[model samples]
Target chain A: MDAMQIANSIPMWVACGIPVCLIIFQSLLFMSKARQASKDIGLSDDTVKKAIRASAITSIGPSLVILSGMLSLLVTVGGPVGWMRLSLIGSVMFEGIAAGIGTQQVGVTLGADPMTPTALAMAVWTMVLCSIGWVIFATFSASRMEKIQHKITGGSTKRMGIISGAAIVACFSSFVASHLIKANADVGFYFSKNAVAAILGALFMFIMMKISAKHKKLSEWNLTIAMVAAMILTAILPIGA
Target chain B: MNKEQKTEYFENTYMPKMHRYGKLIGVIGVLVSFIPPIVLAVVFKAIPDWGKLPAAFLTGAAAFGFLWIMEPIGYFNILGPVGTYMAFLSGNISNMRVPCSSMAQVSAGVEPGTEEGSLIATIGMAVSVLINVTILTIGVILGTVVLSKLPAGVVGALNYLLPALFGALLMQFGIKDIKYAIGMLLYCCVLYVLIYLGVFSWLPSAANWLPIITAVFGGIAFKLIVDSKKDKAAAAAEKKDE
Candidate 1:
């Protein structure tokens, strides 16, 4: 069979489904355990329910973004593999890059050259092996993170809080900065629609938070409203165009 | 439960159980990841060149190895333990899981570093995972049909979703400390410009990680210095009172 046929085959679907099922199972299991633990620790049911609602609502936009990304993956790698990888341990960019590298190793350029079964196999192998590092590291090192946290903050909860807040701000700022700046091959650097979107997103969120302070119910929808407003404004503007 | 008892339960019972289960599931995930490729080779008789396997592995590893170590460490403080496990396994860490976790904490009115925060973060992450997978499954099955029907502008706007999400999250965290938020944002922009100018060309993959490393550690260092200065001022006030 050809690459696409093999990629969309029943065995392929079943093979890919196993990992996706595992992820769902793990999420459900952890959710149940955490729910029980939250009760034991005296977190209000209202708080837990609100978190669930907020997170679920917040996930929709990004999940749609991932869906768009998956369209590219689907065309190149076929449905089953793309579905499985994205559902499990691969981002859209990483998966595309890894697939390209894999095909390149077998003397082919992904999307540029027609895929052969051998090339597909190489792509799958590279994707899996490339992702293994994160799983293994996180598995072994996750339990030990508290010790590192303790050492960093000198065992003071107050210091720990400060550091944690700083780290979060820094990490996200880095993400925003990267998005805001566009590097062109000919030009050095310039601001683009992404920057506009980010700025607008922050502005909208700030306003939303202010409004939510009084409305209360609006807080749960703050992120969704901010994101949609920013995206719409960025799209309508002709800054980058 | 009282504060001490709650802390004790989280550290002693809940955390330990999560760790054990997380490790087990992680191992299983790693092993299961190879199934599709194995199935391709064995069932479909599609086999890659054996000699090239190592080169391919090395190529991928070289490109992404640093992220494997850096991301887990960088995201740990925000994600906490259980969220980390779910996030790494489920992917979309920065875009989907982190924002969801942060928003959950915000809506729940919990501080990010506390045990209560961690539990809320886990619930947030789990909820996102469930919704994300469900959406993905349905999208995959119907993507071609639905996506083709959508306006090109709408599809194009999807790219901005991530930046918008990041921007919103930055504001979410930044509002707590505006000075650090602006400082870190500027710091990252400078680093990105430096990277674009090839100042860090001597380092491999400098563009990918330099901003992150500097921002994260730099923020931590800045906080430590500020806190120490505050402590010193408090101590001086106490001395004066004495």
Candidate 2:
């Protein structure tokens, strides 16, 4: 099938929806859990829930907006003749951006070989990457806490989820506007796939953290070990190998 | 927790040993991760089909083995199969194979290896690279699913997630050191300027290094300029008062 036909397939809808649901679910999941955890830890449920929701909402807008922005990315790149070149351009642009930061490190820069193809050969692998990042963020947050100052008022779990979800759809739309109209470039895969997967994987990571917190499954120790092992593997591997 | 209580909690309750153990294992794990590619590159470099298999398989096995071993030793509580699989997937990325020391520098929460934290830094980079690869993989899978549903043009939009995600990830990381963050912002800025100015078509290693080097010194430069100016202004005011 042609590229246009491939873009709007059934599976795509399902994939998109899953992350949407999950993001919505995450606001609720964390709000409730934080509320419950706060109550268990002897903090007031109402207060903790409100604060958590408030903190989370700050991030919701940006996350959703960034994600939705991906939808229209393809249209902006123009028809198929240039998609590969654009994708290539994007690959280098992003890779250079990614590898060039922070320090004079010789890691990713030395190994990165950007693909000028319509698709990154091993590009699908990035979802797992984004997911792992989500995991790290979630796990770290779960384990660490700042003194919760209950300032946000009336931010309930249900309300927060709806607001975040609505905001996400809107933000996502705004971000995707260029792609939607341009009909040339696409958000490509980065917006639709990695962001969704990252949010979902991270939200789901609550289960992992909860279990660990309760001392049932993973402990801090295992996290360290796994972290080290994963670190080692990626170091010697090729870019997106 | 109160300040004292918090300090005590970190000191006693959290177990410093865990972090040290993490660092130690991380170094070894990162070291182990380097093996498959070298081995494969050496022994079976000629085989076409065998090319990806050894790298993929051996790396997967090594990642899992390292994680599994460290999990119990370090008393980690995690998702049983999920963590293993995740690590397995991450351990196998092409980018991770390049021996890039840059991964540690990329992750903010994780410190890069210098003299003090070298081992831990190495471990952290490995993990971060694997995670990046894994997340990218998931994004592509889900993105393609969307692609399959939509027309080809729409499907192409799915590719934008990496930069989007990277942007978000970097933003999150930059929160740690706002001043240092200029380096990243400048990286994008310099690249654009160079490209726009027609200084070069592609970034030479020099183009990349120059901005970052400036940014690195830029931090020190910023502070020095401000301090020196402040000192001069203060001395002038003092002289006038006298």
Best by TM-score: 1
Over the stretch A1-241, how does candidate 1's per-residue lDDT look in tens digits? Answer: 8898899888998999999999999999999999999999888899999999999999999999998888877877888999999989999789999998889988889888888999999999999999989988887888788688778777566786787788889989999999887788876577788999999999999999999999998889988999999999999998863
lDDT of 1 by residue, B1-242 (tens): 88778878987899889999999999999999999999999999999888998899899888899888888887887777788889999998888898898888888988878888888889999999999899989987885667667788988998888899899989988998898899899989988888888898887777777788778887888898999999999999999999
Cα RMSD (angstroms) for every candidate in the order listed: 1.4, 19.1
Cα lDDT tens digits, model 2, B1-242, are: 55355335433433243334323333333333223223223332311133333343333333332332332212111111112222222232111211122222222122221111122222332333333333333434456346336554333333433223233323333434544443445443544355445576443333323333333333334444555588799999999999
TM-score of 1: 0.97
Report backbone clashes per prediction. 0, 113
Candidate DockQ scores, in order? 0.81, 0.04
Quality of candidate 2 docking, DockQ: 0.04
The superposed Cα distance between candidate 2 and the true structure at residue A151, in angstroms, equals 35
How far residue B216's Cα lies from its native spot in candidate 2, in Å, is 6.0
